[model samples]
Every structure is written in C-alpha cells, then in structure tokens.
Target: MENKDKTDWRFKVANREALIGCGLALLNFVWWFGFAYGMGSRPVEEYSYILGMPDWFFYSCVVGFLLITALVIFVVKVFFKEVPFEEEEELR
Candidate 1:
C-alpha cells in the first residue's frame, strides 16, 4: 500500500511553516520600509534634533527600528510554533 502521508499534497507541515515565516518576514520588511520612507520624506529641520541627528533619523530610523525589531522578536517568540522537519526518503 502507498504511504498516504508521503503522497498527500493537499497540505504539508513544511509548506505551512514556510508560509507563516514568509508572511512574518514580509510584514517586517513593509513596516521598516514605511518607517524609513515616511519619516525620511518630511521637511528638514522641522523638529528638534537629538544628539546632533535629525529628529527623523533619531526617532524613525534609530528608535523606530529598535521598536520594530523588538516587536518582531516578540511576535515570533509568542506566535510561531516549532514544527519538526520531515525526513525525506533516500532514492534506491
């Protein structure tokens, strides 16, 4: 009898895991890009500076990046499930 588990293509543990990983990664990328571009596009010298860095740089690029990084770390730790990888059969 054929192994239904091996032949089943409708759903896969690896595929689901990969999809979740890719979604999270894409979400992070979009968030960082939006932060960088949205803040970087504002008028120059509009706000007070921090440590000689522009407010946008200090807040958006530096602090914002840190915040987003932490958020991603938290989400991954809390939401991602650790799935075991399936072993492939060796060809005869």
Candidate 2:
C-alpha cells in the first residue's frame, strides 16, 4: 500500500499571483508613460497656475500621483485579494 500526500493547489495559486502582479505592473507602466509624455509635451509658458504658482508646480502632482499609484498596486497585491485555489489557506 502506498500513502500519497496531495498538494497540487499551490501551483494554481502561484500562477494566479503572478498574473495579478503582471497585470498591475503593466498598468503602472502605462500610467507613468502617459504622465511623462504629457508633461514632456507641455509648454513651459502654459503651465497651470494655482495661487499664482507656475504651472510646472502641477508636475509635482504627477510625482504624488505616481507614488499613490504604486501604493495602490502594492496594497492590492498585499491585501484586498486572494487567488482562488482548492486549498483553504492563503499563500504567503
């Protein structure tokens, strides 16, 4: 008689995690690319003004946007989600 241990669900869980990571990374890449292009194309003279500050100040917002975007992706990967697998435990 042979005793077999079954643990085949991990593969699917890991694959799901990889897929989520890839999708999020791609989204971040697209967002940063768009921001860089938009900023690079904007004329210095046309910078948006806020409280009399030059429009380039708006680019600072882009930096914040990038940070927040990264944080959101990180949070999504870390918390708010779990791969569907046959196992009852979450992957580390």
Candidate 3:
C-alpha cells in the first residue's frame, strides 16, 4: 500500500478548473442580473425592442446565453486538460 502526495498534479489541475468554472458562473450571473434589472427597471412605454423582443430580454437572456456558451466551449477546449483516472502501479 502507498500514500499519494497531497500536491499531485491531478489535484492542482482539478482545483484550477473548478475555480475557472466558478468564475464563469459568476460572470454569467452578473451579466444576466445587470441587463435584466438595469434596462428592465425603466417604464414599459420607454422600453426598446429588438427582433420583436424587449431589448433587455434579448441582451440579457439570448445574447448572454450565446456568449456564455461560446466562452465555456472555448475555455474547456483550450484551458482544460484530460487527466487519467487509473492508479499507477509501483515499480519493483
């Protein structure tokens, strides 16, 4: 039996990816909240429309969703690393 080091590369990679995911989630929330509340706070009569949808809805829900989707894809493809799950056998 053997004990693995606490500072394994796999652990470091996992932690970094987790932090990046949390950051992206926070960014998404902030984007949604800002646009949804900032523009939506105005009176209905003064609201603007884009492609038949309210400006706030279009930007906050539609565009924000697309932007976040693209960002996540890019991050995963570029920054994330594939880690092996199998344990290594000790050399004799």
> Model 1: what TM-score?
0.53
**TM-score of every model?**
0.53, 0.49, 0.89
How does candidate 2 fare on TM-score? 0.49
* Per-residue lDDT over 1-92 for candidate 1, one digit per residue giving the tens place of the 0 to 100 score: 98886664435755765787787677667766775677767777565578998765676568867876786688678765665457566588
Model 3 RMSD vs true structure: 2.1
Q: How would you encode candidate 2's per-residue C-alpha lDDT over 31-59 as one tens digit per residue?
A: 66665566646787766665675444444
* Stretches of model 2 off by over 4 angstroms after superposition: 1-7, 49-92
What are the per-residue Cα lDDT tens digits for candidate 3 across 1-92? Answer: 54666356788899999999999999999999999999999999999999999999999999999999999999999999999998666567
Collision count of model 3: 0
Best candidate, lDDT-wise? 3
Output the TM-score of candidate 3. 0.89
* Stretch of 10 with least lDDT, candidate 3: 1-10
Q: Candidate 1 lDDT (Cα, whole model)?
A: 0.68
Regions of candidate 1 where Cα sits further than 4 Å from its true position: 1-47, 88-92
Model 1 Cα displacement at 36 (Å)?
A: 4.6
Q: CA lDDT, every prediction?
A: 0.68, 0.62, 0.94
